[model samples]
Target chain A: MGQVVLKGINKFYDSVHAVKDVNLQIRDKEFVVFVGPSGCGKTTTLRMIAGLEAISSGDISIDGSVVNGLAPMDRDIAMVFQNYALYPHMSVYDNMAFGLKMRKFTRPEIDRRVRDAADILGIGELLKRKPRQLSGGQRQRVALGRAIVRHPRVFLFDEPLSNLDAKLRVQMRVELKKLHLRLGTTAIYVTHDQVEAMTLGDRVVVMKDGVVQQVGEPLELYNRPANKFVAGFIGSPTMNFATVTVTEANGSLIAENAGLRIRLPDGTARRLRGHIGHKVTLGVRPEDLTVAGAADPDHPCFDAVIEVVEQLGSEILLDMKVGQDVMVASVEPTVRVNVRDKLRLAMRPSSLHVFDVKTEEAI
Target chain B: MIEGAIWRKWAFFYLPMALFLLFLLFPFYWMVITSVRPDGELYRPWNSVNYNPFWTWNPTWDHVRYLFEETLFAAWLWNTMFIALVSTAISLVCGVFAGYALSRLNFPFAGSLGTGIFITYLVPQTLLFIPLAEIIRNYRLGDTPWSLILTYPTFLIPFCTWLMMGYFKAVPKELEECARIDGASRWQAMLYIVIPVAIPGILSAGIFAFTLSWNEFIYALVFLSSPEQKTVPVGVTSELIRGDVFFWGPLMAGALLGSIPVAIAYSFFVEHYVAGLTGSVKG
Candidate 1:
């Protein structure tokens, strides 16, 4: 029943506070991913959970028991490091069997489990080869095979896929999800890639500067971000942000800057009623924008000049100049857009996001 | 290898290489020739007709025979072999453990401790032998092989430790971390995973420690007083040359024979030695 809970987790490296007040409850068989920019304490938190790092003042319980003082071996967990960390001198079979051997399993049982994990990872034929003889992808499989042979209560992944090439990384991501489903083991994965976190995690934890910004399902994080940082971090092409002043007119609120005068929708206006006549930040996602039609008068329309056009086959990305701010619009591939062309774009009312200027938190 | 004219290749690479090889091998060539040369040919004046100092057509086994018969050369060989092997084994065990701990563990003052150990290696043996001789006399180990065996590690352990520290540092820390996470205790992880991965480094350190003790002169010469207890360097030098008259033949013969074991050891583990020196830890 691998349920892991961390309470009041704090880490200090001498005087540098690497991780601050992290509390998380990870349920059985759940694949949770902690993601953020470099030095955001995601890896530190994972290491703490693995019992690899000492907790300054907190409790980490695994399988309903406090493991704060236990060694990593007693934690009954396996980890896949970024570099694979395969034993250079040992063959693949030996590498996979090491953990089982350490745990004092019988020789035949160790062999059977090693081969089973090898077969699962499609590395049975590579059992006799050393790590130096295997390709990057094959070595990665061996590392995974080594971890799976133990049947540990929890699996810790520290940017395991970051070392693979782009094509291989995508391929392994699907395999990892499938492996989690097959084993039904609790896993905590850490990475800096937002897409990986969004795709693989049952619940994604977004962090910034040693603090967790938000924790939710992938779509929830994308749809309703807690702060401007989450909104900008969780999506590709980055949500465009403009520091605009909110003004009330005609019993509504309008957020406007040097180039944008967007009439806030009722939902956004009601939330911003107290925010009116104050400095606020306006946020809009690229995919929520489309070419405005004459009949769509209810939609908020704004004028922008296309500075560059990127044809991505599946979609056309227009880098547009909106007043004094630059924004990216992921438009339909069929749209015939050119550089320096003035176009009117509309924002879906429900998709508009407003954040506080000072706190950078969503309003 | 110079990618240009033929003359450039010859001048830049081949000529210099040939000169370097000649310079390096000339001493060994002289030793071998002198050891085998007849007593008359060696004693002949250089200005005499057909001096032929480089090559001796009349080669005899008299020098080698005298070396074995007239001196305690066999006993010296046995003493040197036993002392070098035991001391090297002792130093290797201490070095590997000290190096692994200093490089990997998170103990307080680990960095300073490592530096301090390395600084011990820098102390000259010449000065160290004076105090060591006093200790040897007090322990009543003055004329025994134990004196040299016990004292050799003073320098050898530090040398081996310093060499091993650099090698252990090159090994990635993730391998041990993964092993620990895989169920091995810290000590088990070191023994099974880290030590095995560092075999090349160990071999290199062992070979160096072995050679260092084998060729060590100051401590061996000072500590061993008995003719039978003396090592090769001391035995060959003291017993062979009777006061002012030097036994060049047996001395050369002894030098030539003394180097064979170290040469064989080097050739045996040449690949690992090179790899260890390069200190590359493949991920």
Candidate 2:
């Protein structure tokens, strides 16, 4: 129901800058995800926005009003924590009613809102149960239900599904997406899971080491990552990186790495015109490589020894060693591969991502 | 064969535990027998011939009557209960706040302060009684039950505070943050959430405080000049001995009666006592 904007945010714990001068604008009703590894400041940033943590130096605005100096309750934001911090002593009904009671809602209003949230979460039967009596997934719903009953301007989720089992996590993920759709409230979700980021976020902000690497639509970030970190982090099985030397072969460009050399596509090669003979990092997602039957001159080809093979029912993952360099590739489920077998892989030139070796920035 | 092996395994496990239980309960069984023995056989040395004399003869209510009517045993009981209840309440209030602060807050010299609280327990009561008596006299609180209630927390609070600090630490920090976002102030969050969750810990601390005050003798003996103001432990021991002539019958009767409140309290909070006592030691 409200947009959130963070401007020039910087947080420092003593000399260590936990969140650098970051800027983000989240529109009303948008589902934005902050994704990164631990210590990357994603949770810190979310906490700052939630007002659970103070900003060392920055401004956060909710619905165009500055909230940097406000208390969490005064900021009118409800947060669901990773551990689902439901009041252990309170029944689900009271847990959800706590914020309403604090707000001095009428008895009828509190009852109605709590019941409505319980229905939405499909936990109507669990209203009388204490939090310790509920399973992890149900407790997570109660945490969400607690936030929902508040009817705050914005909702903040800090890795809310990280504690559940794999299957429950997936089920809850879908439930959260549906909840967002039904409510249409501006929400900020933080997680390290890229799949959750892709499936849940309207805009995914990839971060690394307290700095914003890139922010864009999920597919846009997936297809055209702004940097090597974003490129490697956004994809499943991860994008492979190879240290290669870019050289002018005849009139076109080719990247030579270890025991493999492949001509770059015309469009991609033209972008590398000035960088010829320089060291670069070749980035390619596992899905972009195919197990080729023969050498295709039109496409880039490399021979690699299969070190490990994993069959995941619908797809096959190959861990291959080409000379001294190792890379992972995802092939079709029908592709037969064995350990120590030499496999010819054809790279899709159009899908090849290149980055400067020194800066690790996308070229 | 496997079922027989499993039975053997369980028997081996229970053998030591069963012996331990019997060893623990034997002393209480002797105390009960001693309290019921007839007057003539009460002082008899433990022998095979005198073992059944108690069964044939009539049990006298003389010791019990002497304790209740001839002495201020009822008054001692009342005084002990009062001091224990008041001190336990005081310790809980002080300990809970101090514990929460130590557990959650960052203050100047917090580590040193925690160490200081723990060190108070290490100071021997015998060593500090003279100085504490002087201070109590200075405050004009000597010879009053208030002096014991006030002094008992000196020992109780430090240990109870340490106990509660550990209990509060076990609660996740995020629980309070959630409550805060729900519009609870820090104190409100503690009152509504933290304290309720720590009921077992508080009960354990309360039992410790009550028992310590109930059984305390050194400070009570030194500070209380009036028989009416004396706690049960000091009063019972002082009245039982008169120039090497010990009144064993009335003494044991009073001792047994005095221990009942503490024993019953221990049984009520036994679970929490075990949990809280070890928990405080670690803290």
Each candidate's clash count: 1, 0
Off by over 4 Å in 2: A293-297, B1-19, B44-57, B271-283
- For residues A1-363, what per-residue lDDT tens digits would candidate 2 score against the true structure? 598999999999889999998999999999999999999999999999977787999799998889998887788889999998888778899999998888899999999999999999999999999887889999999999999898888999999999999999999999999999999999999999999999999999999999999999999999999899999999899999998888986898988977888888887898899888798888999998998865466888889999999999899999999877889999999988789999889988889998988788899
CA shift at A352, candidate 2, in angstroms?
1.1
Off by over 4 Å in 1: none
Chain B TM-scores per candidate, in order, are 0.98, 0.87
Question: Looking at model 2 chain B, which ten-residue stretch has the lowest summed lDDT?
Answer: B274-283
Best by DockQ: 1
Which residue pairs show collisions in model 1?
A: A259-A323
For model 1, residues A1-363, the per-residue Cα lDDT tens digits are: 799998999999999999999999999999999999999999999999988899998899998899999999999999999999999989999899999988999999999999889888999899999899999999999999998999999999999999999999999999999999999999999999999999999999999888999999999999999999999999998998989999988877888888999888899889988977898988889999999994368999999999999999999899999999999999989999789999999988999988999999999
lDDT at position B172, candidate 1: 92
